[model samples]
Target: MGAVATPLLAEERVVTLNRIVAVVNDQVLTQNELKNELFAVRQQLRQQGIRPPSEEVLRKQVLERLITTQIQLQQAALLGIVVDEETLNNTIKNIAAQNNLTLAEFRDVLQRDGFKFPLFREDIRKEIIIRRLRQRQVESRISVTAQEIDDFIATQKAQGNINSDYHLGHILVSLPDEATPAQIKAAKNRALAILQELKSGADFKQTAIARSDGRQALQGGDLGWRKSGELPTLFADVVMNMKVGDVSEPIRSASGFHIVTLFDFRDSERHIIRQVQARHILIKEEADDEVKPEAQLKEIRDHLLSGGDFATLAKRFSDDIGSAQNGGDLGWVSHGVMVKPFEEVIFNLRDGEISAPFETQFGWHIAQVLAHRDFDNTEEHNNTRARDLIFQRKSEEEYLSWLRKIRDEAYVEYRLDD
Candidate 1:
């Protein structure tokens, strides 16, 4: 009792190389904790004209991101969002699979880069918490009206842009910031030549596969489908209004330049008429070798066809809680509010009728057409939808602002002195 071992002495007595840098409430952020994030930030800066900050600046940024994360994570906890251990492990495995590596191999690579496995696990855990919290706070509250989407399209038309931008793939011949004037000129010339070849009937994707410098160049310049606001202003402006098979004139930007071709567009064809409102009950197919959502839905369909109560059974069997609690009511979703496959079947059904089992991204759904009013230029309905649209957009803006404020107010300390 008289001789007490100090923590400094105890640490020295053990084989400890990493040091704890910050204590966020009950959580500990260690030196090796932020190594991967710091490395990523450094790499991103180098890709731009920005040089890597000193060890001091990188440390500060890493700690700030972590602290911001911690505060949000705590908020998520307050909202009852907790990432289960199994979820964390599954997320890691999924990430590893996405990178075309086994989980063990991914873990090995992370360890080689000075990142501790537990620290990475905690980072992933925090991300899961943040997402789960947002799903409740934001996604559950998210609602889009048919008028909102239509007005958005109308605005696009007013701007002389494509009302819907297709999945336009591009190959960038960017001049790296450190490139010499000669190198820059050569890159620009290479871009101009690519444009010439494209105009002269060369396969744009083939040339992109051969010569583009952007990340998606290897995937034949495929950027996948994007909505109007999802792309850069200049390129998005040109591509949105162009028909399929249209190519842009050599487009120049700060990141060298690019040539774009709109090879495909998948505008959601299943928009609900503005006068319609709907809800649904879903019985998902279990994931077994022989069973599927369709099979389960078929049984439910028999019950409904026999005049079984829709609302009563919805409470008992529907998997979607957002709607199920209200007797499988989806409230009012405009046409594009649903996935195309589901909406397509629902749109064809008459009011008070039940849809056949339909497959969508979220298992199988058997929808009820509760109400639908014809929209043959109804002024009142249009105005209501317009208001709903504006409200939805305003909510999205408010949520983003809230997230940013949380980020800015966090108390962050760093290990720059080390």
Candidate 2:
């Protein structure tokens, strides 16, 4: 009887370790995995000084997050996306550096804080893979035309608060793509109800944790500081008029209804920088090439110094396809735009001087500085900012929509006991 009881206890332990909490597509999420994630999330909330929601609410939230993450991982695998060891190591090193610790020290700290190093590394790897997958699937497909940038900048100027930044808390009641009228109404009602709760002095972060469907819901829907140009168009229009600590009424969009609270605001500083008009001819090294790229670029530089036509030479020999057709003209570049070696060489050259051949990650180049100026780059900055903001907004919406589509198509089954 004692021997039989020992085996029964071992079997029970095995069952507990392998308990299926949920099934996401082809993957089974174990009880241990869910418990670990829950622990991590609770720790994160505590560190951020936000109160954790009730256990039931938090458990559901964490489970949903795990499901979405598993879906994304499955999609990433299907798309052949992977993070290599070197990149993962480098990313971890950078993270450690940001925290003012060496990699060894960071590992020790994580271990001391009850994190398993192997699991932490794998988590970082998965994050990188997901990021790359998003870049490929969603971000690469988003485009902002020149006209859109012009319109955005013009609108900002008209609004008279181009430099203002808003720190916002948001709650989203999401609707499906092609949602029925009934669904729309239901989502709107839910958003309005949430808004009423907020107005009645319910804690915003706590409510967001329990109810919002936005990506930042876990972080209490805190959409940290955003520039005026960075806000989604719907958010920008609504947020502009709200005072600090003021919550907007539910606003509707294609994705769904949104509720936003303005937590803080501040103005941004003006941008002024040195700009250079430059052009270059690149030569890439190939095994079949008769001449090395460095030697070829040296010859091209000599030709430019000896009264040769730079544009004609660039069109004929430059390997950079984007600039080659335009006479190799890289118009009005600022610092940090070009690769380090390329920028170093270009910025050091005087006006109308052709640089000697130099190698960057992109192979060998001979660059000529056509002109330089101390420019007030506010409009240009706004153009870039607008394009980036539009891209970010589109990416967020498209990603959420895509996630919903995939989730709906997935085979998910919950095994958690009621």
Candidate 3:
């Protein structure tokens, strides 16, 4: 009887440590998980120089985010979406490279910053899974037609704010799908109240942290810089007339009522592409050859520098048959037209200045810059930009709608206080 009582006591301790915070469908979120997420969020807020809200307010916000994220994860599992181990490792390596660290060094840095390396890796995996899920579910469904692109471009031109960019702060008082008139009025009234607070000099970020339902609520509702064409049609209409520092009235949309503050605005300068007229002679690497490609190209470059005819030498020995016949003339090349290694070598060369032998994926090359120009590509740029912006605007709208629909359908039961 005493041994049985001892086992019961141990089981009670385990239950106490792994107390349930929330239940979503078939899974439960534990208290420890919530605590860890809360700690991470506080650290992030501090790093961003934003004061963390009161614990009570933040806990609710974090819990809601956790629930939504859990729902997305469940859906991802159901749809057979996963991040392979190799892909996850490669992503971590890329992140480390971006920060100028090796994988081991990155792990050390995480440890030094008080983050468990295993936890960080899992977090990255989850982020990748969620991103892929969004791509598969929301982004794949959106489309922008040619007529829409044409209309978008024309509208931007007529508005005279085609080149304008806006940095906005947003808050959404959300409502359920097919909400009743009473719910609509309630949400509108709530949005209006929040707007009045902003107008009366309340801190927009703090207010958003406390009340907003937008995806970026935890980030203080800040919707970083966006071109005019990238804004939702509803937001574009209201924002075009807004002055910097002005808070907008609640704008209605399918998701909910929104309030936005124009934090900053700027005009993009005219589109001018830097074009480099360059040419190169390539010597494709051959495993059977005793001479290495780079060494061979170096000898050729020395000959050209020693008063040899470039066109004659290129036509005689260059491996690129297409350009070799044309005296190795590549014509005018823009920034993104060539591979990175090739562009780096050619773009940095002065007119008539030849590069030493360098290796790209196509083997080895020696390049010469003929001339440079700043070409006005405004019309072409605008057309491409318009198409992209229309796609972005549509994607944002659809993603928000999709998110709301999923949240509405998910069965979430909170046991935070219990």
Looking at model 1, residue 337 earns an lDDT score of 68
**Sort order, TM-score high to low:** 3, 2, 1
Name model 3 segments beyond 4 Å from true: 1-10, 100-105, 286-303, 306-308, 312-317, 376-379
Per-residue CA lDDT of candidate 1, range 110-194, in tens? Answer: 7886667887788788878877776677767777677665775567558644334368878788654456789878888988898
**How well is each residue in 1-418 modelled by candidate 2, as lDDT tens digits?**
6556687798998897879999888789988888888888888898888998889888888898989999999999999998889999999999999999999999999999888899899989989988998898888998889898888778888998877889999999988788999999999999999999999999999899999988888899999998877677687888999999999999898889999999999988787999899999998888898889988888888777889999999999999999999999999999999989999998999999999888888888999999999889887787778888877878877887788888788999999772
- For 1-418, candidate 3 gives per-residue lDDT tens digits of 6556687798998888789999999999998888888878887777778877789999999999999999999999999999999999999999999999999999998898778888889889999999999899988988878898888778888889888899989999998999999999999999988888888899988899889998888899999999988877888888889999999889898889989988899999999999998888999988798999889888989998999888888899889999999989999998998999999988899989999999999889999898999999888898888888988888888877888889899888999888
lDDT minimum window of 10 residues, candidate 1 = 267-276
Please list all clashing residue pairs in model 3, or write none if there are none.
Answer: none
Best by TM-score: 3
Question: lDDT for each of the candidates?
Answer: 0.69, 0.89, 0.89
- Give per-residue lDDT, candidate 3, residue 82: 92
